[model samples]
Target: MSRSPSIPDRPHRDIDSDLPDDERLEALRGHYEDLVDVNDQLSEQLDDAEDRRERLREKVDRVERENETLKSSSLYIATVEDVLDDQVIVKQHGNNQEVLTDVSSRIGDRIEPGDRVAVNDSFAIQTILNTETDARAQSMEITAKPAVTYADIGGIDEQVREVREAVEQPLAEPELFDEVGIDPPSGVLLYGPPGTGKTMLAKAVANETDATFIKMAGSELVRKFIGEGSRLVRDLFEMARERQPAIIFIDEIDAIASRRTESKTSGDAEVQRTMMQLLSEMDGFEARGEVRIIAATNRFDMLDRAILRPGRFDRLIEVPEPDRDGREQILQIHTRTMNVADGVDFADLADDTDGYSGAEIESLATEAGMFAIRNDRNEVSHQDFTEALEKIEKDDSSDVISSAGYFYQ
Candidate 1:
């Protein structure tokens, strides 16, 4: 241990008796000044020493706390299986060991069956843990509303109407359904070819409503470990139930809800199990209050019949490629923010881009803008659009040729 340097003693007031009176007074004044300076130095040293002692004491306390923490037994997570008069049964996670343990009086009244509790090595309940949704499930929740809106989507008006009636109407106007004495549609399934605004439709719904939106891909539910996928599904639905008036949009749903086969493979079996849990949650014995489901898939035929039933997916809306008018509308919507020259005619462009989906029209508009930029122009022109269409057609033909070559090989 280090010790503080000792402070010097105060200077004594001493003067020669034979000195002149003025000189003696001057000597006494000098002594007084020196004593004052010495006192200030000592005071500074004392303050510094006290500060150092306090810091050291705090450090020692922190170290002692850490040491105690290290010496304490680790707490294990366990679920309360049953609660009796004097004791509670807890099954430890991972080990699956059930132990009947006495609960502390402080938390005895709070402990209940199905509650997750922290227990010590001796199986003594330490504290009750709050129910936690799986982090994976929580991440799927859309905290920020999607920027896409119904106005941004084109060529899917009827499909959008069906979706709103199935999903948004019930959430916004439950009294209407109640007045009619009928239950609202439980879920909506969007099936169509690629790039036909299926996802944008879902996003439009998400943006149009104030309800909680939880979006996830079906591939995310296909877990490698058994029971994990099903647990995740359960957690997702439970979270939706907790956050009522919630909409769950599962994109590419055919990945997990594919037709079940008798393949005896573990991977297939796990996927089937997850699908079964999803089905039960969609239309189970217990009522799913204020929860709506929306799923989209390009391969609609691949989905299982069970998931396509009336109760599970009450509305099956098909979002196909845009017609000429729809394509023109989509083109106009995409280029609304762009600088276009007078020479560009949307009607002509829409006629030229036949069989194009809404997504393709948006891409065409983007490509046209790129062409204008390449030509060092500030505004898109009809010539630019013509060049862009030619390039896209060439690329499409090349892709078809490549596929054909691969198939022949």
Candidate 2:
């Protein structure tokens, strides 16, 4: 800012020297106030210019950072497949193409098989990356224990015992296996008809043990693209290892362990790849510490022989429909809280339901209650039980007839 002339250097020359002394003094005071006002205006302009400079500096810094990011080289994800004396095999993700790259001594000391790493476009290892766990897999971990205990699961007592032996005993007393001079079973495979208490059995085991329970369905493992399924399996096992003494229950395992064929279909190939990864993780050379696997399936015939082998599933528990006695116990359990007349007998009800599953028995009790409500009665009578059984039987027969028309198994 330019300063306009306000007071002359020689005040006497600007004012009249012949004037009285008081008048001269007052004129000088006016000049002094004018200089002070000009100084204040210049200071305000200086502060505004500094503020503008600071904002521009900040904008320049952000642009510089963006430019640096654009100039940086890109990296791709890969994994170390094998390690040798000097050369290591690295497999690029998505493509599964393996390359033998020479690792520097410093990097080779840190790299190991199964470790995720970053590679350049030339497929050379650049840096080791941390293992990433899937959020879905982590969510499967049960924070609160399930409410279903062994006592709550009626019928199928034998199957429950076998599962407990396979899953619980190992975590409770591992030395029992060592004393017997046997490697504890790696997993237990449960096959049964639907609604036969297979899933309930798994929940019971989760309730009994203090281990982390991670439950995921096999259909969730099937992905739309290649390599994703295998990656998910890897992450799941990695999570189990992170939280030791964990139980991984995979329901409807037939979705992934189905019989592998030589067909060239992409879907089949991807599923097979996922199965191979599962097989490797189950009985691989790496030790499986304190982790137990329990898988259930409705279609045992659909499972691949490789997965059903002795090493993978040491114990194959078959959960069949509850026998007469089991059905009676299941009825007593479901009807424990129901208001039933004294004449209603569980033994007779069990006998009447010859092929009904445990689930069906529970449903029968519920339907019996609904019948009482419909009749505007407070207590369920024997007639209500008989009607529920007849209704369920009719529905079952109709379903069989409808299914038989179009499908042959």
- Per candidate, the number of residue pairs that clash is 0, 0
Clashes of 2: 0
lDDT of 1 by residue, 22-88 (tens): 9999998999899889989999898989999999999999999975874485877777999998799
Q: Mind giving the per-residue lDDT tens digits that candidate 2 earns over 259-290?
A: 87678776777788888888998877222358
Judged by whole-model lDDT over C-alpha atoms, candidate 1 comes out at 0.78
Identify the runs in model 1 with alpha carbons over 4 angstroms from their true place: 1-141, 223-227, 285-288, 397-409
Which residue pairs does candidate 2 place in steric collision? none
Task: Pick the lDDT winner.
Answer: 1
After the best TM-score superposition of candidate 1, give how far the Cα of residue 376 lies from its true spot, in angstroms: 1.4
lDDT at position 388, candidate 1: 93
Write down the TM-score for model 1. 0.65
User: What lDDT score belongs to each candidate, Candidate 1 first?
Assistant: 0.78, 0.77
